[model samples]
Target: MTSMIRMFSLAVTAMLFGLCFAAPASAQATRTWISGVGDDVNPCSRTAPCKTWAGAISKTAAGGEIDCLDPGGFGSVTITKSITLDCAEGIGGAAGGILNSGVPGVTINDPNGGTTPTIKVTLRNLTIDGAGVTQGTYGVRFLSGKSLTLQNVSIMNQGTGSVPAVSFEPSAASVGATLHMTDVDIVNVQNQGVYITPVSGVAVSAFLNRVTITQAAIGFKVEAGGTATLIDSNLSNNGRALWTASGAATANLEGVTIAGSLEAAVFATNGTTIRLSNVGLYNNAFGIKTTGTGIVQSFGNNRLGPDAGSIGLPTATVTQK
Candidate 1:
């Protein structure tokens, strides 16, 4: 047989030369994209996209989702897993952005510890610019997430290195970290525009709806094991527009609106606690300011706005049967 037909034609040419030196399978793409003239080596699919968001979050996948095909500045991103950076359908009407100056435009750290299950980040209709002048240290920095959602987001001018335009500081094992802001918008933040400090048996929690914190110097700050809640929010021109610092820190306001505070529009210190309903204390220079054994409770349908210069009276007035 002619040397067994030449050894079956050299074993089909050595199996096509080992399938042409095969080696291509580094999968990871549950949905990845980014544009503004994308090109991070393609494969971010949706027809070759990718150009920062740290190059399409390492090709997405791990609770994937990194959309936005039109509207750029997609830079600055440090999420570790569990993602979702939607541009909320403004694709062509221009939405997604990130013009940080020094650093930190979003950095949710997720190391995926022991039993896992700690990682959940979602940011929609983005726009986080820490205006220039070397401003920008945080426009979202939930260190080691367990939950952080911001809808219709917009964080601006984060005051150079003074930090805080959103910082749910977790760590200390990342205990129960959680924060949810809806229709959020924080502007001219120069520290504490939403800075819940956790880490020490960490038990942080924050929830603000229709939030809008402006010109902050402390427009919603909670420390210790932090806990905050606001509805129909609006803390404007702050210098201290609601702060519950230290220990059992807690703050809850309904139909909130503390305006033009040069200081004290509800501030509780040390062993904190603050609760008000139908809140609205405008032009405040003082209106419910407690210290040490701090406490401030009022359900008396609050609404003081005669350019409030001193309407402090609430250490317990809960008569809302």
Candidate 2:
């Protein structure tokens, strides 16, 4: 009888141990791998990495992660899902950085199949060099998305083909997207530094955090109902530094510097609401121009720079050709 009791006690102890000490079998997010020399058709495992950004982007699940086996050799990736490309070590190292300059850089492919793609990518600690190739336009184009967040990524030397440096072309209102750019430096765009063209959905907001846009046709063009927020940015050496057509844009400027424009520094029209906070403007022409009932409210720490022009009070609101 004592032996039987011992056996029962052992079985009970084993069950209790399994319940208290055993780890729950939880699944982890899957990761895909990419390399400068990889196969797009192969499995995206660490041993056999994928070839193109388009391939990895299409394969990666929304909540999954993708890591580059070595420094990535980019060839214009189109995103269609939610994935994180951990580019912490930088793309090409000291000799040369990742090239998105010629042909197509990062194209947003939506018309592929199924529903339109809404890609959420987090690119951290990577230098995306455009190599002064402006033919095919844009270093990074966020065409259609639910929302885009670019953190600590540098997009330089875009627009060889008279295309804007960065183009945010949304699909429709049902798929209205927002672009949140953090610490992005856009330089040497021929036509425009940042261009937003609406297809069906005209509502778009572009937020810039510590961004510098220089040597372009226009610094920022807010077309239709497009809105932009500039924070700690430098806009210099452009035709109409900031042009707002359709008077449908709303701009919030904070700690921004605008310099070197042939015409008005900030050309606003169509009842646009332009709010300035600690802003600085130094244009050879008029400081600010407002037409069609648009208003530039000089609020809180906003000051016209040393080379900035006067408002001309009541008469100078409208720009003269």
Candidate 3:
């Protein structure tokens, strides 16, 4: 017939040039699955789940992990690599893994750069609620991350003003940042319930275990040259529970417990530096206050009850242990 119709038009132009040169099947993925009636164009896997957490963190990969196959409200999320947001079981019915408002509720920026200079973020069993009315300031916001780990988390209310329920400032070409809070629980935070300021030759370090800070106005606030380590922690009804202000700040309270602070349960000022072991002070109005060139280093199995006292300068350093 005309050479079989020109060989059927050259076999349909070589099958449309092999379907336009194929190759399109990588959606990252190292482990990504979010539910609550998922569907972020599906592909988050695990039965095709993905509804939030910024759509399964772009199909997870950089240090992967975005599990939460059930609980829904997976909203707030702005992490940059080195991930892990394990909802630690119990999601939808709410047993950790809520995240409302979206003000912060998790925002760790990791400028890892080449050769992986550092980048690690692991938040497990979250429950960050800021229903104290439009909560959106901070409930976890560590800039330029290099390390942040919070287990069994639970950050509440979140002040609409001063804002803080875990806020670590690290950026100045960031080269230092580390925080590890275990069994964390910061309630009614309207200000400083863990706020470390570092950005002056950067350097921030923290490690609070069994942490718990209530109704904050300040329940752990390490300033500029940050450094902290509070174990078996608990700073109650705060208005000021444990503040190490200004530069050169440093704290190390072990087995800590400072109660009802209408102000000053342990406020070391500008030139701060504190270290108290086996500590415990009740009904604080001033259990260990210091100003200007602050310094307090008591370590004799402390338990300063009777409304506690130990005000300022003379560099109170009682160590009989």
Which pairs in model 2 have colliding backbones?
A: 101-130, 134-159, 134-160, 134-161, 135-160, 135-161
Q: Which parts of model 3 are misplaced by more than 4 Å?
A: 1-18, 21-23, 28-42, 49-67, 71-109, 112-152, 155-169, 174-219, 225-234, 237-240, 245-264, 271-282, 285-288, 291-321
What are the runs in model 1 whose C-alpha is more than 4 Å off?
A: 1-23, 29-31, 34-43, 46-67, 71-111, 114-152, 155-172, 175-221, 225-234, 237-240, 245-266, 272-282, 285-288, 293-308, 311-321
- How much is 173 displaced in model 1, in angstroms? 1.1
Using lDDT as the yardstick, the better of models 1 and 2 is 1
- Please provide, for model 2 over 1-321, each residue's C-alpha lDDT reduced to its tens digit, 9 standing for 90 to 100: 999999999999999989897754432326777777789776666777777666666566676766766665556766666666566543322211257757657665444322555556565555566774234457767666666666677666677777787787776641456778787777767778887665553687888888888878777887776788989988887777777766467777888888877677777787676777777777547778888787776654666655786543322222322
The lowest-lDDT stretch of 10 consecutive residues in candidate 2 is: 312-321
TM-score, cand. 2 vs. native: 0.76
lDDT by residue (tens digit), candidate 3, 144-262: 76788988888888767687778887775555678899998888877888888876736778888989999888888888678889998899888889888887889989998888888
**Best model number under lDDT:** 1
* C-alpha TM-score for every candidate: 0.41, 0.76, 0.41
Order the numbered candidates by TM-score, best leading: 2, 1, 3
True-vs-predicted CA distance for residue 87, candidate 3, Å = 5.0
Runs off by more than 4 Å, candidate 2: 1-29, 89-98, 111-118, 132-136, 174-176, 309-321
lDDT of 1 by residue, 199-288 (tens): 773787898898998888888889888888899888878898888888998988999888788988888886889999998887778877
lDDT of 2 at 128: 65
Between the candidate structures 1 and 2, which one is better when assessed by TM-score? 2
